[model samples]
Each structure stands twice: as structure tokens, then as C-alpha cells.
Target chain A: SQKIEQNSEALNIQEGKTATLTCNYTNYSPAYLQWYRQDPGRGPVFLLLIRENEKEKRKERLKVTFDTTLKQSLFHITASQPADSATYLCAIHNTGRRALTFGSGTRLQVQP
Target chain B: GAGVSQSPSNKVTEKGKDVELRCDPISGHTALYWYRQSLGQGLEFLIYFQGNSAPDKSGLPSDRFSAERTGGSVSTLTIQRTQQEDSAVYLCASSLAGQDRTSWYEQFFGPGTRLTVL
Candidate 1:
């Protein structure tokens, strides 16, 4: 069965540092992968979408790297702040599936 | 400028009772989806409505769960005889469909309805 896994433990980092989150999957080849930021009691907001062919994508302070060979993706928040503290989710859009399959998500906590 | 909206931000119901959750997708969004998220769990796909097509009900967990989209805009998900396991946050999302491949995969989600079955 296809599965998506993220770090279940919350990650705590000091402000002004970089935070890296990992997403590993097995048993599926997705056409594209997306990242979303979800705060407590709110819906997820789209952050970035990286296709299998693309190795890396960046938007301002956020960067995502997709390595289909390793069946993994890395999400990075550079110069993190307390505001960046939230649960970041990884979602994959499998071929022929209209809905995305999401990972359990990794929670990041940035302390000032 | 409005995003996807779901009614009843929070619902508490007794076990074995029925509850209805409503979702209003953004204007012109042809694809709508419903998902459930239990505590500390990933989002579970429930149902999908795309234009006039017959909805994909494959993700529904049981026969007691049913959903309908009226006039390709508003949607309702009904869970009959709810059990304690039915407690979760129900999320709704919508996206553009057809022609634009990029836009099709980017979904805009609404603040979920937190349902508690006691």
C-alpha cells in the first residue's frame, strides 16, 4: 500500500535558523507534490507545488526539493520566525486520482 | 474574493443521531472535495464532485455516509447514525477544472467543521 510519512515529533528551533522537514513515501509514483501550511484550527494554505521533473522550487523564504529517485521530498524554511511555526503537510497527486493524498505532517516550533 | 465556505463551524451530536454538513465552493470552481481528519491523523478523502460528472464515492467509509452536490455549487455530506468514531474535522476544498492543468491540482480548502459525536 502507498504510504506518506513525516516526522511525528514536533521540531523546535530558534528564530533566525533554518528548518528542514522531510517527507518519505513508498509504493506510489506521483506526478506532482504540493506543500501546505496549516495552523491550529485553520484550513491548510497552499505554499508550493513541485513536479517530478523539477528538482527544486523556491518562493521567497521557502524552498522545496523533490527527488523522485529517492522517493522523498524536503521542505525548508530559511530564516525561520515564530510566525513560521505551524504544521507543514506534504501532499501528492497521483495519476488518475482527483484528490491528493497527504502525509501526517510535521509540526515546527520556532522560539524567539 | 471569498474562498470555500462550510457551514456549522462546530457541531456536537449524540451518538446514533444524524448530522448534515454543508459546503459552498468558490465561484467557478468545477471540482469540489470533502475530507475528514481525525485527531493526529492525516486527512482522509471522503467524496469528490467534478462538474456534472457522477461523484466518486469510492472513499466513503461506510454505506451510512452519503453526499450530494446540487446545481454544481453547494454540497452536503450526511452521516447517519453517527458513532463515536465519526468525530473529526470535516474539510472541504475546491479547485479549477479543465484546460488549465496547473490550476486543476491546486486546491483551496475551507476552515473545517469540527464534529464531535458523543
Candidate 2:
């Protein structure tokens, strides 16, 4: 069975600091990995995506690193703010499929 | 231009009743997807549509659930004889295209319809 796991425990970090979230998968090799931000009562918003061959991708204050060797992806939010407090999800695209299989997600709380 | 849009932001229906949820993908987007999100759970893939190709229904939980995308634009997911377990938020997303050669298909999601099967 294929599975993707993220840190279930909520992560708390001070504003202006970097917040890091982890996503690990097993039993599959995805063509690409994506990160999304979801707020309460709203659908997810795309953040960044990195291909299997790519080591890193960046967009504004967000950066994502994909390590196929480690079977993990790390999402980073630099200079975090209270507004950045939300659940972040990691999703993977399976072979021959464009749909994403998402992990349970990690909740990050950026305190001012 | 408007992004993806779903109808009936919230719906509360009795168990065993049939429910239909609608989705309008972003204009010009050729790929659409449906997903279910239970409380405190990850998004569950439900279905996918790309252009005029046959839909990928592999993620549908059961035969009671079915979906159709008309004219490669608007889509509707129908649940017959819904059960209590059907209570969840149904999300719709659209991308330009599905092939890897196209731009990375970054999905733009709708606000979602919250279906409460009571």
C-alpha cells in the first residue's frame, strides 16, 4: 500500500522565523510533489511544486525541496507571519496519473 | 476571470436521499478533478476529467457515487441513496491540461460544497 505521512503534531514557531514541515512517502515513486495551504473553512491553495528530478523550487517566501533518495519533501516558510498559520498539505502525482494523492497534512501556527 | 466554482456552499440532507453537487471549472481549463475531505482527514481523490477522454473513476468509493462532466466544462457528482458516511466537503479543481508536457498542472480549487448527510 502507498502511504504519505506528515508530522501529525502541530508546529509552533515565532513570527519572522522559518517554519519547516516534512512529508514522507512509502511504496511509490511520484512524478512530482506539490505543497498546498489550506485555511479553516476554505479549499486548499497551491503553494509550490517540485519534480522528481528537481532538488528545489521557490515561490516568494516559500521554498520546497524534494529528495527522491530520502523519499521525503520539506516545505519551508521563511519570515513566517501570523497570517501564514494554516495547515500545509503535501501531495504526490502517481505514474501515468495527473491527480494528486495527498498526505494528512501538518498544521503550523505562527505566533506573533 | 473567475476561478473554479461549486454550487450550494452548504447542503444538509437526510440519509438515503440523493444529492447532486455541481462544479464549474475555470474557463479554458481542460482538466477537472473531484475530491472528498472528511473532518480531520486528508483529501480523498474521487475522480478526474481531461478534455474528452474517459474519466478516471478509480477513486470513487462505491457504485452509489457517480460523476459526469458535460461538454468538458461543468461537472456534477451524483450520490444515490446517500449514507451518513457521505457527509464531507466535496472539492472541485481545474488545471490547464493533464499531460506532463503541458505546464505543470497546478490545480485551482473551488470553495467546495459541504454536504451533511444527516
Q: How accurate locally, in lDDT, is each candidate? A: 0.94, 0.92
Candidate 2 structure quality by residue, lDDT tens digits, B1-118: 8988999899999999999999999988988999999999889999998874645889999999999888989999999999999999999998985466535458899999999998
**Candidate 1 lDDT by residue in tens digits, A1-112:** 8899999999999999999999999998899999999999998999999998999999999999999999999999999999999999999998788898999999999999
Q: What's the lDDT for residue B12 in model 2? A: 95
Error of 1 at B35 (Å): 0.4
Model 2 local distance difference test score: 0.92
Model 2 CA lDDT for position B14? 97
Per-residue CA lDDT of model 2 for A29-105, tens digit only, reads 88989999999999999888888999999999999999999999999999999999999999999778888899999
Residue-level lDDT for B117 in candidate 1: 97
